[model samples]
Target: MISNLNEPDFIFLLKSGDTSAYQQLITVYKKTVYNTCLNLLQNSEDAEDICQEVFVTVFQSIHQFKGESKLTTWVYRIAVTKSLDYVRMKKRKKRFGFMRSIFSEESNEPIYDRPNFIHPGVLLENKERTEILFRAIDQLPENQKTAFVLNKLEQLSYVEVAEVMEVTVSSVESLLFRAKQNLKKILGDYYKENEK
Candidate 1:
């Protein structure tokens, strides 16, 4: 479908409206797309939907491909935009019922996996604390949280992140610096309070 797809083949296929080539594109990049969406949304269903939408958008816009960047980078830029927009929309929806929302619900996380050396019981004991940490991450301003996750968890280079985030490399560095500082303060306070 994509023929060679090392670079030139992809440009030709995409520009020629070869739908089969799009299928190959999705197959090759599906896991990365799904996982990146999951990292942003924190919900499986949302991630799945967003991944599908991303592929659709990419295919529809393929004719506009200007070769300004590599295909992968172009697709990733779309993924980042869709994901950030989803977060903002969700934030707006939650703003009205925000307080009751937090106190009235129990988290629905199941299927915990632990290290082999650790007992299941011990793992459960730590699970709530881990949930708290994730909640703190969720509470972070979205941009800072995005930087932290992409840089720390996904291991993207600052330059790669800059392209995805549509910013300069120095801006990415500053964003991550502030994110790290804020996370340390928030997480450290949580631990100190628990210790006391």
Candidate 2:
């Protein structure tokens, strides 16, 4: 996307072992891929490793791109898989970031300072809800989780997700429905516990 040229040009350059093209491509996509990883891992070091793996896979497989989807989409697909695998393999999965309470009154929060799961102000707020949702999202099945992340959080279109996922639009739709239902069930249970 940074080059604004097309996926074909990137693929050609990448296939010919043009390291510069690979560098440019990484620059274009690193943050989005890293964020996807961080949200999934909730760990900075692991997220960094997953990001590197995604790019390494990209460099190794440019020839396999087949122009099926945008290079960005392919990269994200690799990243999501890597992140999910990283999470499962790590298996620490406990809730984290509790230190965010120290600076709750501060307007700006530190990135590594640990986000609090609760708030002092309004009993209902976005931060707490998002945290709960992300926690449940972490428990989703692989395909459903991947679909939700790429299509919903990343804002990719269904057609784009379909190409990256190597499935039809209808399948993406079906996965999303199941994903939503599963998430709703999980979060509903969470809220119910809160009511107790």
Candidate 3:
């Protein structure tokens, strides 16, 4: 049903409260959104939760979409923003968790921040290397990390990444360049420290 519909028609159907259209929308984009959230979040449950949140936001905000970008680009933008926001909120909670434990008489166990990252794009045999690469990717500054994830991991074209990131193609290029350089240094230091 959706395959025959053009963008305007699909948007119209979605905005008009067509249930099938909305279902089709989720069917088409769920994996894309889930993978994006997972890569940024590195937690399956959080990714699943945020994937649902992205669709809810899309549903609520479809009217605000002015057709300035492709639907997929807009959806990707929402997913990226939601993922980063989740990460930020988690960081804030972690920062204050110690205080919470102190005041609440909770167990004094050390809070481990890093989850076991398993990128859906990675092969099982390459899990160790993938984890190392992702750890290095996490060390990058936010914009660079986002660009690297969308372009390299998500395989979005530079133009698509630019649209999702709301930046020029040149900016995406610069971010990726700097991201690569930073990743190399980070990974190099990791190996150096572990070479004992």
RMSD of each: 6.8, 8.9, 1.9
Q: Which candidate's TM-score is highest?
A: 3
Please write out the lDDT profile of model 2 over residues 1-196, one tens digit for every residue. 5567676777898899998887898888888898777766666777788899988988988878787566677787788778877766544332232344354566354344334323222245476676777778777988888889788877788988887778899999999999999999999999899996
Candidate structures ordered by lDDT, highest first: 3, 2, 1
- Per-residue alpha-carbon lDDT of candidate 3 for residues 1-196, written as tens digits (9 for 90 to 100): 3588999999998899889989999999999999999888888899999999999999999999999999999999999999999999988888787677777775676764867686766788998999889888888898999999999889999999999999999999999999999999999999999999
Query: Candidate 3: lDDT of 154?
Result: 90
Give the clashing residue pairs of candidate 3, or none.
none
Per-residue CA lDDT of model 1 for 58-160, tens digit only, reads 9889888888877877887788789889888776665634554555665343323211222112367687665666656666787787777677656789988
How does each model score on TM-score?
A: 0.78, 0.74, 0.93
Model 3 segments beyond 4 Å from truth? 99-112
lDDT of each: 0.74, 0.76, 0.91
